[model samples]
Target chain A: MIARRIIVLLLLLGALAEAWPAAQTLVLVVRRDSPVTDLDSVTVRKLFLGVPVLINGTPLRPIRNRSEPHLDEIFLQQIVAMSQPSYDRQILNGVNRQGWLAPSEAASVTRVAAELNANPNAVSFMWERDVAHNPNLRVLRVLWSD
Target chain B: MVRLTHSLWVRMMSVVLIILAALAPLLYLGVSRIVEDGYQERFINSVRAYSRLVADQLEALDAAEFERRAGAVLDGVVLSGQVVFAQIVDGERKIHSSITPALGAASPREDYTFGQSPDQVYYISHQVRRPDHAVVLRLGFDEIPTSERIRATQRHVLLAIGGFVAVSIGLALWLSAVIARPMVLLQESAKRVASGDVHVQLQSHSSIREVAELNLHLERMRQELVGTNEQLTREIAEREASEHKRLTLERRLLHRERIVALGTLAGGVAHEINNIITPILLYAQMALDELPASSDLRADLQRVVESAHRARNLVWRILTFSRQSDTQAPSTVFALRAPVEDALALLRAIVPTNIEVVFRCEAEGVQLTGDPNFVQQVVFNLCTNAHQAMRRDGGRITVTLAAEEDPGEPQLRPGRYGVLEVSDTGEGIDPAALPHIFEPFFTTREVGEGTGLGLSVVHGIVESMGGLITVRSASKLGTTFRVYLPVAVALSNAAGAA
Candidate 1:
């Protein structure tokens, strides 16, 4: 009984430790052929928060990563710097008032990569480690780093 | 019918029902509250989660062509079974689901909890972020599922309660039987005993000690009562026999005294009658000597003398019946058959030929210690009375002479006796006249037909000897006279009458 309880306790602590945010250098990515190379943190935040932005006469659209574990939470915490509800609320406000479209969400790494390559203005946030093996995608800028 | 209101079974059932009445409401209320709250919380939480999801979709909509696309988002919310109404509220702008019902009747009221609204709808709102603006997304979830679930749970609870109540009543019935069975049996048994049927022994079918003990006591009491009743019955019978004996003795004594008084009076009357009739007889004989042979007056004179002679003989018989014998004549043991046959022969000659005199003597040598003349007279008188009784419709006069070894009467000494049974198939003596039959001059015949002294003389003759006389007669049936006399045993003054 003691051994089983100790194992369960260790597992729970591991999960809690994993759940705590750690310093990560999150960068915005786009297709290598895209015109956009870097964006300032302020514009990146507004774009991710459902603000309508255009770069070099092309409409900028943000794509959110859904399938990556805890990627949305980390992005919201570091880049958006807002709670999930607050972030969603800001985006919905812009859509309702200006009739603007909100950011699109992709469910997998390949899906995010596909969106980035297809749309030149499409940008998405992910850990830099995930972008390393995808040669077709390039980091536009460091979205956040500890 | 047993009165259920006062019965043990009813009492037991009442207690069980009272307990159920007390607990059923508490159980129903407690269970209903738990089910309602659980379903309510679950419903509110689920509706809130679905509303948040709809808000998420609103926030995720693309800005370009947002108007056309947002309509699809709202319609999707309406398509989901949980939400019946969906809308987005922005400053100075409102967007409702295209498929939502027209709400011109009433605006949706937001619900804080699942069951807080009467519309069976739980309304909630979530804010969605938009570019420089946040919009409120309101969703109304249908609460029917939660309400139906609660109702189903409550039905199950009610079924459980009902089952419990049924089982309790069954148990109460069984318990009441266990308690009331012995008492009911005892009560029925007690009723039978009260109705005087105590032959059945009181018994206990109860396992309870007190009931068994009570039965034992009651059984003892019943036995005691039976014994006491038996003793009282025996005492009553014996006392009745004693009273009858005393009355019989009194009657016999009174009859004897009357006979004695009548004998004294007859003796005196006979002496006077003899003196008067003797002179008349001598004068008539003297006149007859003087009368001429051709004279008709001679015959009439002769009748006067004849009647005078009859009066003389009657006075003589009266002397004998009155026991005016100079000294008590020596009573001799004699052949009973000879005298009985002689009396019957004389009776046959004198009575109507239709009254056949039949004599039977079974005891050939049975001798009685009384005077033979007394037996002869007794036979003559009883036979004469029988002859008179049957004069209207003549019948057989049977003279049965048998030697009785056992006395027929209880007052008689145990000895050999000659029972002379003289039975006549003739008109019987009246029952009202039966008691006075042996008394002097008491007869059913008309005065000119009989002197009514036949049975009186017979009773006197038997009593003077050591004997008893009993007569049995029924109206229109027949008359029988049984005369029992001691055989060859001198018993003086043995007078008994029946």
Candidate 2:
């Protein structure tokens, strides 16, 4: 009986982890000094899925952030509109079919912010709060909400 | 059970089998552990090294194109056939190969060593660093083949142990036969020796030191036994020859003794008959003298006188059979000491060196009215019997002659006599046998030792000479025979005493 309670408690914790991201929103982020601004959800998704995108004829670099537990899943659901497996399949399919290089990845919000500052057209997903106090970073668009 | 215990082959084989039974299983277990351990160690080392090589390759990959070729790299890992599962994980993202890990087998758990998981998979992980992030590469190597190898090696070990046991038992059998063969041969030889074949040498060949030494001792014993048996056989043969001679002599002496006894009995009857005849003859003659010169009564008295005279002649003839005339020589007045000395001289020459003769003649002037041979014969018989009595231990034979007076016994009158006493410090006669000693054919000596007639003849001679003989003996002490004879000088005294 104790084991069943433990398992149910773990299931409830997992549900809360998935449900807690709903109050937060993920925005496409870049360096404040870069020319990138106001990118649409289509351009954002294309940039994260290993498709090369251009703004003012400048090549864009997409950075994947893994700072939060369900942040990537929220981003892939709202903007990319795909499950985790399907999104991974689509990105690997582009690398195999079109011979495109995979996008760069970062594990922490600080490393994501650092990559955007270093690259003039680098793009990434982060919580609104991460760029809220950073003067060097800016949000091009809302990547996801809930 | 008896047969099995007695058999050498069974005994040796059982010992070998027991040793093997104890050792073989231990040998199998130890060897199997070593073999399985060898396969397991090699399996774990190689799998871990292979997984490390894969992670290193990923670290060197082109980071800009890693995601596009990551699936191909992981697919290549699965194609190696040892990796039943392959995946690259970076935080919440996991990129896997096309292979579905064991095709619905039980889920693979991370295994730290060989045989840790029931899924027959060895799980290992290596971290590959990319320019942007690090991915952890994990691989599950198939464990079934290594397990199969271990099992096969263990089977081989078991078979080898079995073979060793069999070879050991075979060697024991051969060795036991080598030892038992010679012993069995020796047993047969011993049986032959027991059955009186002393000539059968105790021989058995063996290389074993103790057994060879035993054979040597047995052969020596057999040789000694043979020599002893031959010596015993020779002694028995010599004894048999002496015995044959003794029995023949005994038979002859027995016949002679019977005749002597018959003569002595007849002589006693004749003496009584002669006394009656003499009275009849004298009365008949006196009656004739008182009758008339021509009377008819004189003829009848003449016939009685003639018949009495015939009867007297017959008595004299019967007296001759009493062994006194066996000498067949006429009697003469001879110095009895001379012949007595001569017989003693002869006895001294013939007797063995063991006996000593001591002679003393006190009656020097005494004369005996008989053939000198009678005195010689009597002395020879007495001395010979004394010599035989002392033959084994070699004692003294004493013979003495003296003028003595006869004791007033029933058979002996009080008179002067020449007494010859023969005594010996030898094996004495039994007191029970003394009364019968003077009877003919009665003897205490063994067969062929004497005719048993010596004392009987001596008795007859002394009686005829107006003397008597007597014997006194004690068991193991000594024996004495005193013969009293009336000499010429004692004739008047003997006649008056009678």
Q: What lDDT does each candidate get?
A: 0.78, 0.76
Task: Give the Å shift of residue B456 in candidate 1.
Answer: 2.3
Top-scoring candidate (lDDT): 1
Classified by CAPRI criteria, candidate 1 counts as incorrect
Tens-place lDDT digits, model 1, residues A42-66? 5776788788778888888899988
Docking class of 2: incorrect
lDDT of 2 by residue, A68-101 (tens): 7677645544445444545677789999999876
| Candidate 1, B1-498: lDDT as tens digits | 458688887888888999999998889889999999877756654565566556666767777756787778888878877778777777667888888775421456545555666788766655455666666667777889879999999999999998988898898888778778877888888889889887768875778888888888888999998898889989999999889988988887897788789988987898899889988999999999899999898999999999999988777767666766443558677888988888888887899888888888787777777578788889998888888888878999999988766664776887678889999998788888887887666767766877666777677678777688998998788999999987774432242211
Stretches of candidate 2 off by over 4 Å are A1-146, B99-107, B191-200, B229-242, B256-498
**Could you give candidate 2's per-residue lDDT for residues B275-310 as a string of tens digits?**
788889999999999999989999999999999988
Candidate 2 positional error at B434, Å: 32
Residue B115, candidate 2: how far off, in angstroms? 1.2
DockQ for model 2 equals 0.02
